[model samples]
Target: MTYVPDPARYDGRMPYRRSGRSGLLLPAISLGMWHNFGGNKPYENSKAMIHKAFDLGITHFDLANNYGPPPGSAEETFGRVLADGLRTHRDELIVSTKAGWQMWDGPYGDLGSRKYLIASLDQSLKRMGLDYVDVFYSHRPDPDTPLEETMGALDAIVRQGKALYVGISSYSAEQTREAARILKQLGTPCLIHQPSYSMFDRWIERPAQAGAPVLTEVLGEEGIGSIAFCPLAQGLLTSRYLDGIPADSRAAAIDNPFLTADKVEVRLAQVRALNGIAAARGQSLAQMALAWALQTVTSVIIGASRVEQIVENVGAVERLEFSADELAKIEAVLKG
Candidate 1:
């Protein structure tokens, strides 16, 4: 069957926000290709999720060089989707990829060095079969490398027409400030920052002992937008674990190391309390969790393995508003 996109896909069902004072407008919820879209997963299933996401007005698709279990497989999979289905709508999509993690073995395979970034992006472009990505991110801050060098490479990538905008991920507030300054001096403003933010992980809201501002505040002051990853805490915020870890769940999967049984047990009570609040508000736990992250950030990146999951997650846009009392209740639950 021909994969034709819905004509009414952009009928304002999903809200778009300006990415950090930039001209680019990203969907409130962007789909991330971190897990489940790799070679280990079924190709047809992954394709269905991507198609479903676009049909739901999710124009932004985020990926990274080291996303897949085997590394680089996710990009390769996305490349197939682009060639087969999304080629006609290329201009309407915001596709992004990143580096700065351990991509390949050896000295130049990882980090924010100029050589590694440039080469890694080249490989990423080849894997995705695209001339340029909408945004290219240094996936993490490289403490060993000078800020000027990493920011310079990002600026050069923009100038070379390889990436329309540049960003940093998992960078500390202080590091973000310095990188933004350097990119500005280099004639390329840092457009956005990708940080891991969820009710369980509130590092971005914590006051830095070094006197640096919180990450969200710094980005606001610097005119940089933010996109939060792991807004659901990797299934902890979802109903899938309410009863117990399903045998097929990510926590039970041997390949996934980030989420384990012990980790889920520690947060079970908190999740149960949060579920109660979600029930009272007439929304799913996952939806409320995403809305909580979006209360401050510009956008949230969602990872889905199934088409139904994408459909349900996109419903978060509908119930984004929360009253003051609701906010306090959520805070109380987190603190408790």
Candidate 2:
């Protein structure tokens, strides 16, 4: 059977926000390919999720060179989906991919060196079966490499028509400021910054300068948009752990190093407290967590393994507004 997308995919079902001071607009909730689209997962399931996301007005799909369990497989999977289902509507999508982590073995295969970034993006484009991505990101800052060199490579990629825009991820405020300045000088302003932000991870809210604002505020000042990852804190903010970690959950998976039992235990109390406030707001814990993150950033990247999860997560956009007392209660819980 042939797959045709819903005719009304963009019929005001989702909201879009300007990416920083740029003309580009991203969905309030973008789909991330950080997990669940790899070779280890079912292709048909991944395809279904992608189609559902698009049908729901999730125009942006985020990817990275090192996203898969066997790195690079997610792009390969997404490439097949693009060619099979999304080829005709490419213009309506904002596809993004990143480079800058350890992608391959050799000396030139990692970091922010010009050689690595260029080669990595070339591979990423090939894997995704696209001539150009809407946005290409330096996955992280390379302390060993000059910021000018990395930003210059990004500018060059845009000039070569391989990427329409350039961005950075996991970079500190100072590094972001410097990179944005360099990109601006080269006539290619930084489009967005991908940072790990959530109620559980509030590093972005911490003051980066003695008397200045936080990193998110700094990005606003630099005219760079922010898309927060881990907005659910790896399921901690959701009801997934309310009754204790399930054997099938990420925290209970032995291979998952990012989320462990000890960490969940440490934050369980806070999570429960926030859940109470979420109940008062007439939203689920996951929804409130996403709404909280989007309250500050331009958008939030959500990873879903199933179509139902995507449906539930996108509903967060409906209840984004919070009362002053609700906000105060959330702060009190976090500060506890």
Which stretches of candidate 2 lie above 4 Å from their native place?
A: 208-213
Across 16-76, the per-residue lDDT of candidate 2 in tens digits comes to 9999999999999999999999989999999999999998999999999988867999999
Range of the 10 consecutive residues with the lowest summed lDDT in candidate 1:
205-214
Compared with the true structure, what per-residue lDDT tens digits does model 1 show for residues 1-336? 678998889998899999888999999999999999999999999999999999999999999999886799999999999998787899999999999999998999999999999999999999999999999999998989999999999999999999999999999989999999999999999999999999999999875776768888899899999999999999889999999889988899886788988889888998999999998988999999998899889999999988998888889999999999999999999998
RMSD of 1: 1.0
Kindly report which residue stretches of model 1 are placed more than 4 angstroms away from their true locations once superposed. none
Q: Best candidate, lDDT-wise?
A: 1
Q: How many clashes (backbone atoms < 3 Å, residues ≥3 apart in a chain or on different chains) does model 2 have? A: 0
lDDT of model 2 at position 228: 95
- C-alpha TM-score for every candidate: 0.98, 0.98
